[model samples]
Target: MMSSFMRKSLGQFLATLMVIAALAVTSMPARADALDDARAAGLVGERADGYVALVDSNAPANVKNLVKDINDKRRVAYQKIAAEKGVPVEQIGAITAEKIIREILQPGMYYMDATGAWKTK
Candidate 1:
């Protein structure tokens, strides 16, 4: 039903939009309280592999969903950075996780070690 030129143009436009969306999502700051509150409540913690994990198995549904949302966003950002740096996503996550554990984690915050044990920093 559409001409070749129109289809090509639409394809390019969609691709551009996807790139813009990805950039926007990656650049935007995380929403407040969603993660911080969960962490403070001992519902979620950072994993040594650079992902969010449930510290309390009995955490609320909202807290679990929050962890999934944050980790999904992080995966997208990591993929973008990995592509730009020509490195594996796992490497980026590992390095990022180390930095997070060493620098970003605050006192009294929880994080999981490589052995899957929860530790408070």
Candidate 2:
């Protein structure tokens, strides 16, 4: 179990990481036919689990593949962080999702809230 000091340190660490992640997402250069494009075009949406999902069930193969690839990477990252911090991977992911939704999501972008419904940012 984490001590009080360790929990405080972890909280600070997560806050800093969230800011960095938000800045990274916001500062990225947009590329054609990429994640940004997919998001802007309403082809995809962010989930409360810190992963991207297709807004439409009939989205193209490319969108599916992109979501799969990105989510896979995120899962790996979350797992690493969770193991290091002795926390559940889902907790890390949910925290990350909160940051992304509040700081990184742009107007017209879609995200799933706690009710499992997609809403525009």
Candidate 3:
């Protein structure tokens, strides 16, 4: 017995999940591995807004480039999902963040919390 708002929220979350699944399947393994390596090396982190970010301001240029490239692709995916679901991109981002931080991110990886502070989990 879900309220209308709850039902709508659930529907949007499900749509976001489908988009994320599609992105995971379509993403190149080499690029995904590079992002994984950077996270393991503490060079980059996951933002709360479904984007990859630099962990350190002094991270190497290559790490910065990798984050930028991955984030650009993610933004496009989020926008597409948001439009199809009639939800805000930020909402897509938050749902994606939940899956990433809770499921995808490895133990040593860094992720931003609700307060926008990066934490290792």
Sort the candidates on TM-score, descending order. 3, 2, 1
TM-score of each: 0.73, 0.79, 0.89
lDDT of 1 at 120: 95
TM for candidate 1 is 0.73
- How many angstroms is residue 79 displaced in model 2 relative to the true structure, after the best TM-score fit? 0.2
Q: Model 2 scores what on Cα lDDT?
A: 0.77
Q: Write the residue-wise lDDT of candidate 3 on 12-44 in tens digits.
A: 779767768866865689989999999999888
lDDT of each: 0.72, 0.77, 0.85
Tell me the spans in candidate 3 whose CA falls farther than 4 Å from its real position.
Answer: 1-6
Residue by residue across 1-121, what tens digits does model 2's lDDT show? Answer: 9999998777757754953464355433543248788889899989998888999888899888888877776777777767766777787788778877888788999999899999999
Candidate 2 clash pair list: none
Candidate 3 whole-model C-alpha lDDT, 0 to 1: 0.85
**TM-score result, candidate 3:** 0.89
- Comparing 1 and 2 by TM-score, which wins? 2
Task: Give the better candidate number (2 or 3) by TM-score.
Answer: 3
